[model samples]
Target: MTQATAPCCDANPDPRTLRGCCIGLSVATCLLFSGATTAADSFWSTIQLHGFAAQSVIKTSDNRFFGDSPDTSFDSTEIGVNASVRLDPKVLVAGQVLARRAGDMYDGTPSLDYALTDIALIASPERILGIRLGRVKNPLGLYNETRDVPFTRPGIFLPQVIYYDKVRNIVLSSDGAAVYGSLYNDLGEFSVTLVGGWPVLDDNVQWTYLGGDFPGTLRPNGSVWTGSLWYATVTEQLRFGLSGALASLRYAPHQNDILGPGQTDIVYGIASLQYSARRFTLSAEYGLEPVRWRRYGPLLPRQKVTSEGYYLQGTYRIRSNLELMACYEEGVADSDDRDGSEFAGVTGGLVPAHAMFSKIATVGLRWDPTPNLMLRAQYQWNQGTLVLSQLENPDFPRQREYWTLLALQVAFRF
Candidate 1:
């Protein structure tokens, strides 16, 4: 997944960095293979290596998304390599590196997506418990943990209302620790995960929260706390999940800065459900976000608001290797100002009311010609620009209230 909250550097990546990452991945792969062949029964045999690469072409009838879409763009691509080694029966080490390019949001920087040590506390047929240390993916909604892997995604793009790409860095991954446990029984299975860590903060976070980059610096005020609980039926036909997060940040002022030191707190929660039959799957998720800002001098007063988002999606397997999908999603930046009238009024009409919310309807097709390859095409009708990021579309005033997008992608995994 893209960094959910952190705003890093320029969107255009350095050529040196891209080359280094590719060379590093090649070296790592060779070393792993060499060790495996050197000692089949040794530690090498416990190693697992996997990777995936995907490229997408996107076009839009109006409003820019994932590049200059009106002119047709190929700015969306993802590549990742991961490896795991079992050091002992109860211990394992795993890591992954990812390079992603998403229009002006990301610059194909090769970054360590995750590097963790997993220690099993308990292992049995009925129950299991474990702890992960190091940078780990924040287990948010159903798709967040695995969003970076195209093969694992149900569609070319996730429901942006919930798995938003604009502020993805804010909740993408964390550095710290996590505890997970699972219980299995005839009736159903229960599972839970708790995470305490600091999110990767960057300029993008500033863009998402503060609107733009300030002269001063912004950093995590403290650890972010996230948790999730899930339950599934015996046959796994029905599943439910509840997840939430508490995140905070602080900003320091520079001399002569327009703003003073301030703090921002976000409280978010979501409920997810999915039901699967032999050929079709139905899924839905709803999320609420309450945000608070305080002590930002006279220009920015203490304020709070709750935003809401939800989506309903379904997919039908047309054949052994093909599927059809459709989804509808909506998001409101402020439930109290769902139409943005109040917000726009407060801004003295500088911002349009339509900017406060977004709605999207989509239809898509997925085909698997080979076990490791996937082809997808999707069409989206959208209303509102609430989901578009300022970094990608700097000319906010020129944004359209309604737009349509078409996307096609090819992916391969091993």
Candidate 2:
């Protein structure tokens, strides 16, 4: 007997409506702060504002990324503003608003990135406990929380294998609460965070998983939970982290749609390590994501697939203003079917085997022209199309197994 496919969203709200809502929220927040007294002794003195803007140019030998990169596209831009205020010694509130455009993946829409209130339950020098309520950034791999900030990243682009942009929204942040704690001792310094909440689902997520803009819509149907543990030595030169999450979603089909309702469960874990010296830094991360699907319709089968990926990266500061970096990243859709031949065969060769995995070697240079300005240039040699966004490369048959990409970006922060 055949089963129905997963249920997904049939339609979404207008982009302008979403943008307007975010803008209104930001305006209200600003108004709230404006009502505070300007006196030096007032709580306004403890407020801080920060933001950044970046633009990138990308070119590709084959396949499109971030735009029509067949030639060169300047279709990538990121801008964000954030604020934080300390209500007291133990209470703080922080939030950020962002607008981004990246070809077909994102269309320069304003959104609420993160807004949370943090309370220190136990405050001490060596040990502290805290809880955060609101939309919080997910504590996953090393670079996930700060992925949008160019200054905090080693290169223009992070390793795509583990931090794939295709499914970024699913892991970026969540609307939930978290409890965190830290302990310091002679043995080591350790920190732990546990969070449970609902994930943000968007059209991009649906496109990434369903292969295109399906008639049905996909949304988070159940709760998602994540936890991370980190350790660092007394010297703070070496650090390690372990993170994991369980995410579930349901797809509801539109009336008259050919697809049936379905559900997906994803469990993933990541291990990360980093070593830093005065002018050199080395880091690596490995991740395993196992996905299970049920009642996915006749075209798709009910199956369990485990994806694995890893990356090794190093950065060296040649001078106070110049830095060089290199990295090797690899990802496989299924460890048991590394080549994807079986998948292609099962799908009647409609999907290429290269779609199952990706390997990338990259090198880049970063120049800090000033304290708040940065310029970067990078080159990548990629094998396979596993990590590329389907929205950008709609025609899979036109994609090449081997391709090269060059990117240049300018960023400013204040």
Candidate 3:
């Protein structure tokens, strides 16, 4: 599913601007059910409606991220509404519509984030099995499922190393079905999930893989297979998970194109761990993706490389409503050439070695003035430019190897 821009429901150019109307719709839906008779109250009780909106201002000493950050950009925004309803004791339906704007990567086009019908096939106090059919969020790492929701995230920005915003659309969600199971006992709880689907792809995915969009179309060659295994302590103080995916895509070139028809195969995996206490939390996730490109001719010959990313982070609550966070993270475009020296040499210095890797250290503060309002401020020191987007920073050769960034955000939810 390629999410193309479309005219708004109203006459507005961007759907994000009509968020108020969407919220009003939510309110109206709730009110309409408020007058339900006693016989119909059970159905109304099963309905749940919620929405969230967030805006952020970002400034960077150099380079572009989410926008022309060097000039103090406010190009990042998120707005969405989600609803869920129980159709029966063992059946439920849920969905979300979202509008997001992020520099050159995403426009504020309204899109279906997810829509799914979940059915429990086997239910018991100690074990359960279910399946979800329709569009569903991929359970990639620890955060991909709720990546766009500010209220559910630990910070304004998740670690770029693991969540590449430039190609987010490729991994955000998929259209198909997923089977999941969970078991509970005194030892702990264990869960497993398997999903087969076609993920939504967009221009960002093309740019990230092909360097640029040629006179051709990129489409999924087949369905993607993703799986995850997780476990948590009995006290819910510790948890860990292993997740992975296999995906493939093909290119159909034009009559006289610069490239030949090519195929891309990707193998992705992530390991996550976390520990939580009364006021402090520690977490880490490491990811590896091996990409193979084939049949692309001389200009882009067959090749394979494994990229790596990982982060270590900790958060401490200063009070019931305030928290402080610190993190260190790194990303390498190719594990075999961690310094990108071989890559730079092959390109004759046309691209710098810094373009292949990045290291960052960050500190931040988050304050919850109320249950529905959140404010956050963060500062980051970054080295290298691996995560910078080509669409947003055309002058890639001139990109600085070191930079600093500061961001402030406010979010509201209901």
Candidate 4:
């Protein structure tokens, strides 16, 4: 997906304004660096700096994955720099700045990904409790928190069924607070996290929900709430989690806009499980997302959709530095309208039926010649376009129901 400019939503910052904010971030980073060096030796010792960079090449036989991948595009890149400072034994501050370029999906713009203060109110050998304030990562299924990090993710690309790239920005992080606690016992470990915050309302989010050509702007109107509960065995070989979130937003039309005021409510839940051994790992996740839209003028009718998705993945370690993985993923835009006939009928057959569902099979390999350098290659067979980003696949009529994609990536971290 490539990032393109569009009319700003009511709560969206202007592109120019965001550029200026990036400049401010640059200055702040410099100051933080200077303070780390000039403050006290102890203070400097408490600060840590880390970063990662990655580039990928993608090619698709029928549809583009990132940019016009039909010709082998180098339109995927990710770079991030983060710093953390320990204010006290139980308090810490951390922030990350990221620049990501995904053909038509995201532009290589520097942005503050997360800046949060973590305070551990209770800490013990067997139990821990903490709160995170500010821009915090939303703990979705299993891999969301570290999804952006190549080193942390199980594969180069996560399963689109549960982690759809089209709405990544909306679910990635939130501006708010979270309370988390964990307990360790002889039998197993249990943890819980609850968060309430305002979701990031960006152009991509609007473009995903409303057609990019829509005249009105979509913005967040209310807070979002999310919670997760996780359990793992004492050896940490088996783990499972349940997570859910509720998000609300509204659309405000311009004076000349053809669309009327509209509101959207989304509720989703995910169940995840993973089993890890010395050389093999098996994982599976299932999700249900119900979305409601109301009052989009007379042009767009009210809608209620319950989408369902799931994935099963397995990985085998061939060597200390080599791993192989395969996954089967499926997603349906509406459980009741699996073929999209109802949606197409409602839209006067303007939308393709294939757009309502997607099934993908993927196989990939990862090699780490060095601890800080990683290489990955993957192939995907896709049967639908439900997870494709509208910004990337603007010409919906031209999209193919079946497509093949090949991707290769190199990543480095320090």
Candidate 5:
């Protein structure tokens, strides 16, 4: 049956925000009492609990970006539980909860910010249409849809080269709703979507000393809107798809907050191409952003920031249990506000020029000894360039950073 009428299954693993976890309790309750209701007659109303858990161990010679220490950091583990229930034949409800190492999450920061990521309801009355409300992915890019699960991704992490909007986990997911649908013909299926929402900000930002010892983030709240469109085709031997996305956010400065725009806007544009052959998958993307600012308080600068980036990744099936993967990416950021750039500014200086660029080469092996388990090992060499030396402090290393890691993941569905 098509997804629209297939009797809503458990929530897929995407909703991992703050309140998303509440949905999990719903699943646990149903699971504890659902055994008595199973029959073909109401089979569609069954409940399912889904989850994604992962742990990555890296032998870091230096915490390059995380200045806590320039030496070896501790091994980290991140786990999340997502429980979903098919409330009705046409509706699905889900909740998620996550636990990451104190020094990790969204960024290399130390935060026990164990809060809900997303809590929402989804309905797909037809294969051509789907709607979700509550905390949902803003639907801005290809990666955002699949980012919550590492095993479903092409890389250990979505290339930071182009995914740096993650600096402050900017506009990751929002408290809102979205509608998506597709038009199908004998030839292909074309899809479209429109999504908008607001983000709940937590006190997790680190502010630089502002003379009198007051430090905090500006624009405590930012308005956000994210949307996208795509088309897909599947032939006997070849499958292809085309997609694009947009993200826009506005932040108004706060009183006494030094590192925020008087009023700021962020926009992202992206296009991707994908092709699959007998045992190979190839994907490439190009993205651009034009950041604009206005009404800066005297504490800030007046300026416009624009940047662009691209990445290409390919996976080759070497054996039934192995694959070869590699990708190359680079981005250029230019800002009118020198010192405070990236999330809240202050990472660099105010000059309209290439702010920074990152280059990385990774080769890895994937072994799926069991259907629900995997073992992966990879070696990566990362190099970054910053227009100023100060920008190269921890993250943008003036020199090359090298690391080799072995990671193991095991998961199951009940």
Candidate 6:
């Protein structure tokens, strides 16, 4: 997905830090190339800068309410910046920043929270390998990297079922590196990459409630390594692609609430397929994570959480500037317990841990009134299962859960 096809953005059009960084690099790269600036550096002898902004309004409804009301509201605004400099004809560098509101994401916080979003470099495609680093976004699935941009995506909201981790875990980056290349083969053009690294940002940690004492804190502490292989080719008016990965996440011992000193073994796999033509494009993906969470705490439960998810979607370009899109997703998680009840409803009444499921369906339209502007509107239906504590529950502690939401966003690119 590309940001150009999404919706809603205005005000705070760019972040000052990223702007300064890229501009600084442009000047440095120019000085390194020659003693001074060159004519080739410009769109006419300089740097090119541009960006987009967006705002979203979300409404929610719960079928069965345990607390609060049956309806709620949230708003999110985002600012994106893209700057590029031509060090020379054969060498160039580029950077991007994405800052969005805290809105519905962080319940305890207000006033949009921001961070260093994405940083990458483009090189000659013919090289044996291309590399990129620095708080790099993880491209685990087909649309994870480009879904935020309207021009690259069919709809405003990507399948939340798949992007759930990315939305909440903003530290979705690798502090390592990746080497990639394209090879010509009989099957098609093969894109191969070998990547590995650790979490780039370690400023945030998640917490879970037990009672007066806070335990069961899920800390993002670890190092990950993975490799990928993909293939895509063009035939007539149609194009198709497929990708796969084998990765490992090892968490070193760290002390916390529920988890005193622990680690989690993660083996995740991903696959995707896509086909396209002038009128429409279709794509789908499936992902699985086999996890074994271990801890050395009397209150923490030794468990293995298996997570799996998939989605199917399509977009049809009705005309030169208008398009319609839709998608459906199903996600599931199964946790296995060794004891009778690791957690129960009451005090000392071993709590029973069970399996959980989630599903979502979304449909929307994107209006490209002009090449640089997009308008989007979408409706989503979601449902999930939850467990509440006996008395002063565990967190929100509701046995079962369900929700209906209406989301609208507008996106633009320059």
Model 1 gets an lDDT of 0.82
Per-candidate clash tally: 12, 19, 0, 8, 23, 31
Count clashing residue pairs in model 6: 31
List, residue by residue over 1-414, the lDDT tens digit for candidate 1: 010112334432233233333433444455446545645575767889999999999999977788889899899999999998865667667888899998877878778787777778999989999998777788888889888899888899999889888787668877778999999999799999999877776666677787666677777899898899999998899999999999998989989988789999998899999999999999999999998988878866788878899999999999979999999999998898888888778777667777788999999999999999999999999998788876676555677899999999999999
Off by over 4 Å in 4: 1-41
Local distance difference test, each candidate: 0.82, 0.81, 0.82, 0.81, 0.48, 0.49
Cα deviation of 167 in candidate 4 (Å)?
1.2
Question: Which lDDT tens digits does candidate 2 get at residues 1-414?
Answer: 001113332435533334433433454355446534443365678899999999999999998888999889898989999998776667677888888888777887777788877779999979999998777788998988888888888888889888877667788877778899999989788999998877777776776666556677777778789889999998889999999889987888888766579887888899999998999899999999988878869755687888999999999999988999999999998888888888778767767888888999999999999999999999999999888877677676888999999999999999
After superposition, candidate 1 runs with Cα above 4 Å error: 1-42
- The TM-score that candidate 4 achieves is 0.90
Writing each residue's lDDT as its tens digit, candidate 3 over 1-414 gives 011111111121323223423433443344335434332546668999999999999999999999989999899999999998765667666778999999877877878787777779999979999998777788888899999999777788999899888788667877778999999999898999998877766667776777666667778889988889999998879999999989998999989988799998988899999999999999899999999989988877799989999999999999989999999999999999888888878778866788889999999999999999999999999999888876676565668999999999999999
314 in model 2: Cα distance from truth in Å?
Answer: 0.3
Give model 6's TM-score versus the native structure: 0.71
Q: Model 2 — TM-score against the truth?
A: 0.91
Compute the lDDT of residue 293 as modeled in candidate 2.
76
Best by TM-score: 2
Q: Residues 136-254, candidate 5, lDDT per residue (tens digit)?
A: 65555567654646677776556665565224334456655667776666666566776655553322211111111123333323356667776666442333333333333334344
Judging by TM-score, tell me the better candidate of 4 and 5.
4
Q: Cα lDDT for residue 180, model 5? A: 71
| lDDT (Cα, 0-100) at 209 in candidate 2 | 63
Query: What TM-score fits each model?
Result: 0.91, 0.91, 0.90, 0.90, 0.71, 0.71
